[model samples]
Target: MSLPPADTAPAPEKGGDDLATLAKGGRTNTMGFVIRLVARIPFLVIATRLYGAEALGRFASALVLIEIVALICSLGEKRGLAQRLSEGAGENRSAEVNLVYDGMLLALGYSAIAALLLLAFPEPMFPNGTNSPYDLWLVATIPAFAVTEILLAAQAYRFDIATTVRTRAIVEPWTISIAAGLFFYLPGTRDAGLALAFITSIYAGLLTALWPFLRTYGLPRDWRPAPRAMLGMSASAFPLVGADAIERGTRLLDIFILGLFAPPQAVGIYYAAQQIASLPQKLKTSFEPILSPVITKNLRIGNMEAIAAQVRQVGFWIIAVQLGIALVLAIPGEAVMGLWGPDYVAGTATLAFLLAAEVVASMAVVSESVLVYIARKRNLAISVGIIALQAGLTVALIMAARNAGFGDGYQAAGAAGALMLALAASSLVKALLLKHLLGAPVSNWRWPLVYAAGAAVVVGYAFTFLPEWIELVVGIPAVLATYALVIWRRGFDEGDKVLFRKNVVPAPDASSPS
Candidate 1:
C-alpha cells in the first residue's frame, strides 16, 4: 500500500471533523470492549475455577511487575511517539518511519536489560513462589510487549485505531483465554498455564500489531542506530515515562501492597475484581491512542481552545460510558464475581469500589492527554504525588481494617476505597490544572449525568430483587438501556450525538453528475 503524506493528512480544524474522528475511534473501541469483555470472562472462569485463588494470586502478583516493567521499557512511546512524529515527521514519510524505529530500538534495548535482570533475580515478580519453571520464561515477553506498544503507537499516529482494537482488544484477550485453557490440560503445564498464556498472548499481540505497522510505515530506509540522538530522545521522554509509570502505578500499587498485608487468596479475590473493573479502564486507555494523536496535532497548531474542547468532549464520553458500565457490573457485582467461582463472591465490594474508581479517573486520564504535551514536568509531579497519596491511603486503610480484626475481604475493599479516593483526587487536581493551562473550563460534568445515573440505579435496584441469574442476564441490558435512553434524550446535545452517527456520504444526483 502506498503511504499518505504526513503533512497532507486531515487536520481537525473543524470541530465536526474532529468529533467525527473521535467518535469513529470511540465506536470501534466500544465494540472492541464488548468483544474483550466476552473473551475475558472465559479466562477468569478458567483461572479462578480451575487454578484456584492461590495460584491466580501468585500469577497476578508476578504480572504486576512484568507489565509495569514493560511499560517503562517502552519509554512512554505510547503517547510520546505521537508528539515526536507530529513535530518531526513533517512531510517526510521516511522521517516518520525512522522516528518510530528509534523508539523501537530503544525499547528493545531497555527491555533486554530489564528482562535479564528479572531472569537473574526473579523474586520481585513472584513474591510468593514460582508456579512452575516455565514461569521464568515470562521475562522474554518484556521485549515483545514493549516493541508492540511502539508499533501500535506508530499506527495510531496515522489515526489507525482499528489496529489497536484488533490487537489489544481481540487478538490479545482471545489468545490468552484459549492458550490458558489449552495449557491447563497439557501435561506438565497446569502450574504454568497462566504465565505461559500471558507470554503467548503478548507475542501474539506483537505480531498482530507488527503487520499493520509494516503496511502503514513500511521498513525504514537509510535508518541507522544513533546512540547520541537516541540518548537525547530518552532524556526528553523521561517526564512522560515517569508520568506513565506513576499513573499505571496507582492502579497496580494497591495489589503490590495487598500482597504483603494479606494472603494469596485475598489478593486473588482482589485481582479478580481489578480485572473486571479494568474493562472500563480499557475503554479510557484505548481512547489514549486516538486521543493522543488528535491532541498532538492541535498542539502543533497552537490551538489550545480546540485542545480543551477535545478534552471535554472525550472526557464526558468516557465518564458517561464508564459510569454505565460501573453501575451495570457493580449492581450485580456478586453475580459477576460468582461466575469466576464462589470464592470470588467476596470481592463484590472491591468490585464496586474499583468500578467507581475507573469512572472517577476518566477526567484525569483525558486531562493528562494534554498535560503530557504542555506540562510534562507538572504532570509527572502530580502523577508522583497521586501515587504517593494512593500508597499512603491504601496502607492506612488496609492496616486499619486489619487492626480492627476485619477479614481479608474488608482489607481488600479498603484498598479499593483508597484507590477510588486517590483517583478522585487526581481527577480534580488534573482537571483544574488543565483548565488553568488551557484557560478554558474542562469540566465534563453535566446535570443530565446525575439524572441518568439516578434513573439507572432505580432500574438496577429493581432488578436486584430478582434472582441473581436474572439480574445478570436481563437486568444488565435493562439498566444500560434506561441510562442510554435518558442520557441521549436529556444530556446529549447535537454535537455529542456524533458518537452514535455514521459519517454519511451524500449520493451524486443522477441528473447533475455522471
Candidate 2:
C-alpha cells in the first residue's frame, strides 16, 4: 500500500493546533487508562489469590526477560518510526509504507533469532524456574509483541491514537483477564494459566493493531528487502534502541535482581505493587506515541521553542495526573494491596514507593520524547547512566535490608525506594539537558501541585481513621476530587485548560470575521 504524500514544507505557525492534537490524544488515552485500570484489577486478584505469590513471582521473573527481549527486537521503532515517517514523507508515495514494512521485516528477523535462542537456553527466562511447560511457549509471543509495537507506531505517525487505546487498553487487558480465569479452571492448563493467558493477550493485541495498520497503510507495493537500507536503518536505530531498552530496564531491573537475590514470594509482592503503580506510568508513555510526531514536525521547522512548550505542557499534565493517582492509591495503600490478597498487603510500602517513582519519572519521560530526536547519543548515554545507577542502588538497598534482619516486605520496599531515587535523578538530569538544548526553561513543577497534594493528603488522612473499606470507597474519590478541584483552579491557565476542552476554536479577528 502506498501512503499519501505529506507536506514537508515549513508551514505557518499553529501552536494551538498542535496542542489541540495533543489534547485530543491525551483525552483518548486518559480514558484508555481508566479502562485498563478496571480490567487489570481482576488479573491481579486472580494471580495473587488463586495462583499464589510464588507462582506469580516465577511468572513475573520470566516476563521480565521476555518483555525486555521483545522490546529490543522491536529495534526502537515505537518512537523511531515516527521520525522515519516524517523524514520520508515527500520522497514518494510508497516510501513511507515501504519504510514501515522494512521495520516489520527487521523486527521479525530479530524476534525469530531471540525466540530461538531463549527456546534453546530457557534458563534466563525462568530465573526462579518455570511454572509449567506452557511457559516455554511464551517465546513465541516475542514476534507478535514486537510487530504490534511497530504497527501501533505506524498508526501514531498518522496521528491515530484510538487504535493504540483499543489494542492496549481494551483488548489486551480484558483478553488476559478472561483467559487467565478460563485457563485456571481447566485441569490441564491450571498450572500455566498466567503464562498462557499472557501469550493469548499478546497475540490478540497484535491482531487488533494489525487490522488498523493494514487499513491505514495496507501492504507495501513493490517492497523488497534491501540489505543495505535495512543495515543503515539498524545502525541509525542503535542509540534509540539503547535509550528505549535502558529506560525500560530501569523499570524491570529491580524485579529481575529481586528474583535472584530474594525469595519468589518477595518478588511476587513487589510485582503486584509494580503493576498497580504502572497504571500512571501508562499515562506518560501513551503520550510518547503522539508526542514524537509532533516534536519531529516542530524539529523539522526549527521550532525549538515550540518543542519546549509542548514538553512543558505535556509534562505538567502527566505529573499532575500521576501525583493524584499516587496519592489516592498510596494513601489507601494497605487496602488496595489487601484487595489482591492478605499476602500482598505486606507490599503496601512498596506500592507507595513505586507509585511515587512513576510520579517523579514523568519529567524524564517527557524530556526524552524530545531528546530522542534532538540528541540521540546524549539521551542514550543519560539513559544508560540512569539504569546503572538504579541497578547499583537496588542491589545495595536490598542487601542493606537483608543485613538489617528485615523480612521480604522490607526488602521489596528497599528496591522500590531505589527505583524512586533513580527516577528522581533521571528527571533532574534529563530536564536540565533538554532545557540547555532547547534554550528555554522546561519545567513541569508548579507551586499549585504542592498545595493540591497537601490538601489531598490531609483529606485522605482523615479517611484512614475510618474503616479500610471506607478509605477505599469514600476516601479515594474524596482525595481525587480535592486534588482535582485545587489543581484545576490554581494550576491550570487558559492555555493549560486546552487539554480538557474538546474543541478549541480560535477566536476570529475583530476586523475580519466579526
lDDT of 2 by residue, 187-230 (tens): 89999999999999999999999887777777788888999989
Give candidate 2 misplaced runs (Cα > 4 Å): 1-13, 507-514
lDDT of the structure predicted as candidate 2: 0.90
Candidate 1 error regions (>4 Å) = 1-13, 504-514
In angstroms, the error of model 2 at 462 is 0.5
Q: Judging by lDDT against the true structure, name the best candidate.
A: 2
lDDT of 1 by residue, 1-514 (tens): 3444333235455545666778888998899999899888888888898899999988888888988999999999999998898888898978889999999999999999999999999988877777899989989999999999898888877888888899988899999999999999999999999999999999999999988887888888889879999999999999999998898888899988888888888889999999899999999988898888778777777878878888888888888899889988998888898889888888899999999999999999999989999999999999998999999999999999999998878999999999999999999999999999999989888889999999999999999889999999999999999999999898887667777788732222110111
**Root-mean-square deviation of Cα positions for candidate 1 versus the true structure, in angstroms:** 4.2
lDDT of each: 0.88, 0.90
